[model samples]
Target: MMFAEGHGLHPGHENLGGHIRFFNLDSGIFVRVRLPLLTDHCVLDSVEGLLVLQRDEDTAIHLLHPFTGDIVELPPLTSLAMQLKTDYTEATKLKLMRHISASISVADDGVVRVMVILIRMMRAAVATSQDTEWSMLSWRVPSHYQPLSTGGKQYLVHDTFFEDIDPDVAQVFQMEAHLQDTPKLIVTIPREILAYPVYLVECDSEVLVVGHNDMSFTHLAVHRLSDLVSERYVPVKGIGDKVIFVGGRALCVSSKILPPTTGNAVIYQHPRELTFSQYCLGSSTWSLATDECSMSMSGLTQGPCSLIPHVFTCCSRRHWNKGLMYWRDNEPLTWKVKQKFRDGVNHSHDPSLISPTRLFS
Candidate 1:
């Protein structure tokens, strides 16, 4: 979890021009850095490994590569704030920016394309670094459904059905996505769980839907999405030594690839609350990571698929997009799943974590 301006800013943090704290979910690690971009800025979210920041004074947008100290500026969202409502303040505008699912792409010409989909409005805005204003994307989500971004793509998911919005595509971290790629419903929820809230996420390149087993949100249920099959979604029994982070972006990574730890578990942060919990699928167990835990995995300098950019600065715009999209992170996930949420026991979580879900959630 990355902490920055307005979010998890400590008492002394306000004085730092730019400051961020990093926490690793799995291994319980924390790192803090100070970088001055302006007087103050809120770390709104992150795209790939870049921090998406909103300047407090002007509401301008910026993409910050924390490690390399690179910043890309976008126009202030003042116009957007007015478009969303007739009467509002900076606080209200910042609230609208919460949980927004955004995707970004840098073309072969160094032009950066970013798509921002407001959560409550379900309205999309598209902008490029070369443009002066944001253009609206005609896609508006249905009233009851929710928009989710997994595997660098966005989707609108509800209890019964979910389909891909198929946001921006310019080749990400070495993954080749084509402009011709279209969005479609990869799976539908079973009638049994239709009453529960369902969400879509990509783990190890496999799309999965997670939801609660009951109205209490007591347990979690997971299933894999298989578009190639008839019914589409296959029930996932276990993630097999792999850990799933159910915060910000639902990242499912291998234990060997990051801060190593015991796997086959799900770590989640409550959206409406500041509580975080870890659920063990195998033992059907639960543990409290923190009482004031709010998982963000967003890099704040306050900023992996290692997030470490090897050739971001000097690479040629023409060929680097292709090369960067496929940057090597060869870790793999292995395990068998039964497609059902098992009932297990509980345990105490690691206390070393200040806000444990940094990397996992």
Candidate 2:
């Protein structure tokens, strides 16, 4: 799933193959575009009249009129420039500006809106906002395309590119039509926890993260997003695998949450020897799992959100699927530890486990 900040929406499609679903919370409408080909990339453009999809090199892009089911090519830049220069005249500027002002609502409310109008007038007086034949300039000219600042402001010139969108498509990041249609929200998560960030949906609940210094064993307490109630942390060596809670039960699941999969059999079987247990968000005492056994890297699947003492993950999978993975709950789901090998099957089997730091020091 890709999040578009400009549009204030998060749109995602299934990989391998799936339909596109656009959710605009403002409009309260979810639009679906079902195409025969996979979605490479999509933008809600305001260029007028067309919704375009340009695929990346990894996948071939197929464009179909979402409504008419007809194929259209993007207009050539050369012809498009000629048309914009010819039709966009002095009268068009006032009309476009009026439409633009009416369409946008600034963040500072009326104050910012008044300031922008003042700035526009100042620039126009100094021949900055409008001077020579900007409309006659190539679309690529910086003058032709207004600098899109940090707000929901878009500029519209003459309409030329829509002349023929039958066989050609332009690779673009932001589009006009889509931006005009959707309202977006920006959710900021800590960059450090981005890779394995877990999602929690609890109203007014606070997720706690505890940090322990490996050398001193001191506890550093951190409160996470209270609204969502999820905790994330970096794994430090020597912290035992366990999630503790203060007053509530903690919900833990397989390390994988996105696209929520089940039956970790996909990554189960021969697991890796876990050397560290990353202490993510948790309280001091994690609740007991239904099963009292230690959860290894081979067994976490789907379940209600709870606190896990510690979750285990494996990157290298030599025996099963490469990247075959699993999670070990603070408490085992079933009352059994079915590891393929016993802990002390061979005291002298592997040399890695015999290091001075591991065995003696």
Candidate 3:
């Protein structure tokens, strides 16, 4: 699937962390693209085949479709930006803010909205396409995202990225789009959890959390946001024939959606480390994937929304299928993927040509 991958929203400003990474995850192979069109804006988050982007010129948020080139603009953050106290740290400065992640949704009425988390605020703010400016969120406890929008609600995962955080304190919230009602709570008291950080995901219309047992990430937890009146999390015994792919968005799909052998397991890609591993629920053990695209490297995170059914990606895949053998002066970006076996699966086509084959050999 196509997801935004980058260190921060500000492209090139945060120590060369500017720019977005779009990659695809088929049964197991990895194909990535570098967007030349999005070279300037900082991409904050993505969902449902739409990207939440921040304009470097004014920091206004936008929903962009990389393929159709459609754009939906939202109001500026003037109100939220003015909330920054002069004494705030430089990193948190409205202009220099780094580590800002955005999750978005579109109402049935065609209204667009977003929830943004800036490290400087230590809290999140919500706004919609109709709003004059941003509105600060007063969540009872700090809830964060890897947020997914489904069933007309936006879900925020707890902010477990805090250091020295109490392991017992974590929550998953069903956020109301209009900010009129108190958030619905799903408490998952992970007292037995380690410091490996937690993530929220939606699968089969149910919300779940992916946490680690310890620092190793070798042991993981996937619990359903309970449907019982208690509103607590329940352990998922087995995923049946579904495979959970955890990354920017925790996606659960049938093994048939990917390679035939990729089922009844949880595949995780470390958000920062970009490492991939699989844990089979049936086996209750971790093992290396032996699929065709078994192991590869991009040194970045993947998955948020949508899927592209192909092998090679150019700057935009702008003309990858056009059978073109010449460079379009504008499409200058190409990706290099390294396989674990040192097979060095580089796109060996003419550097300027749009290719469909996997073999550069």
Candidate 4:
């Protein structure tokens, strides 16, 4: 199952609201689930089927299970800012402006672990199921660190190097643990690729580092990190039989599990539309995922939208034969797009000029 959560008109602009939409890839069925509490909050990330939502007013973060309607409140952003000796107002503004990445994992013992990276400050906070508050951890690396999720575990990668954080200290906050150890460099980025804006995606235990060029095109480099000292980066020409979804988080899956057409492709969001485009790795070209693009404008006129790719699963392996499912939701418009023209030609659409008639009635 794949799900998308976004705020938009419910079949019409008569009512604007936020909803968690579920798409059954196999059955081609779409269901919209309303989330009232998250109506005004910003969804930072989704992991293990739970959304990390931050309240706009207070910068309070919470875990929301859209399907079960379960909410777990974490320590407010003010607490984290205080730990860094930063002003709360400025911290809030920074978070809203930047793309904040987070990772959520559930241990075998049922303990929920969450790690949120504050890009601006180069700091991170960890919250566990047993914690009453979030524990702030500062990164010693010069370049900013990005969080990656794979195999129910979270890892951080800087420019071209994988930085290993102490797992023992990550679970339980020990101030002394910060001085006891240093980050170990695991893999190095290939000299041929630009290292900035790199994204780490774990597929079937193999780590794939995707480097995005200035042209918005991507190159893939694979590595096996099972042994830190012996691991090395290997350049790959293509990803066989697997389609990767890249955005706030990178998800990799076998093409056999998804729709037939999605094989050997990378599904990523378009810069201008709420829709997604599939980049066929073999051809090194892109085409719209027409099925999903068709539903992008169903009830929306003009607004900012976000697509979250999710997979739903059942408890038993016997039921897994139903095949893999993908879901996505449209996010609400949070920023206004200013109309600008280049060379006396109208190059952009003004949200103010959007016609209500274009919305679904």
lDDT of each: 0.48, 0.24, 0.51, 0.47
For model 4, residues 1-361, the per-residue Cα lDDT tens digits are 3243222221111243544455653344677777776545655555566766666456577888878889877766655655666555643433432244566666688776776655556555677767766677655423433456444555565552343542111110111211212334444444344344555666656866655433244433333344322433344557777766666456675665455445666676655445566777677677765454434432233222222233312111111111211222222121111111211322111122224332100
Better of 2 and 4 by lDDT: 4
lDDT of 3 by residue, 1-361 (tens): 4432211122223332333444443344344334454544544455567766666455577778876678888766556767655685432355433344555667789888766665335556778888778876654325464466655466666655463666555666665555545667756445464234666666676776667756665677777666422654455777777777654446666666455345677766443332345778666787643332322223232232112112212112222211111111222223322121143322222123313231111
Pairs of residues at least 3 apart in sequence or in different chains that clash in candidate 3: 11-18, 12-18, 27-259, 348-360
What are the per-residue Cα lDDT tens digits for candidate 2 across 55-145? 3221111234454566433321122123333355433332222211111222333211111111122121101111122122112211111
How many clashing residue pairs are found in candidate 2?
33
Candidate 1 Cα lDDT to native: 0.48
Tens-place lDDT digits, model 1, residues 1-361:
4432221222123344355555443454556666665235545555577777766566678888877889888877765665664365644554555435567777888888777766666566767787776665554543333444444466655342232342211111111111213234444455444224555556666766666665567777776645313554445778887767553235564555443234777766544433345677777777753322122222122112222111110011111111111111211000000100121111001111213232111
* Number of colliding residue pairs in each model: 19, 33, 4, 12
The C-alpha stretches of model 3 lying farther than 4 A from their native spots are 3-40, 89-92, 95-98, 101-110, 138-146, 149-152, 157-169, 180-184, 190-197, 212-221, 228-234, 247-249, 253-261, 269-275, 290-361
Best model number under lDDT: 3
Q: Which regions of candidate 4 are displaced past 4 Å?
A: 1-18, 24-29, 56-58, 87-99, 105-111, 141-146, 160-183, 192-197, 204-206, 212-241, 247-249, 253-262, 267-279, 282-361
| Model 1 CA deviation exceeding 4 Å by range | 3-12, 15-18, 24-31, 82-99, 143-147, 150-152, 160-186, 193-195, 213-219, 227-233, 247-262, 268-277, 283-361
Candidate 1, after superposition: displacement of residue 215 in Å? 6.3
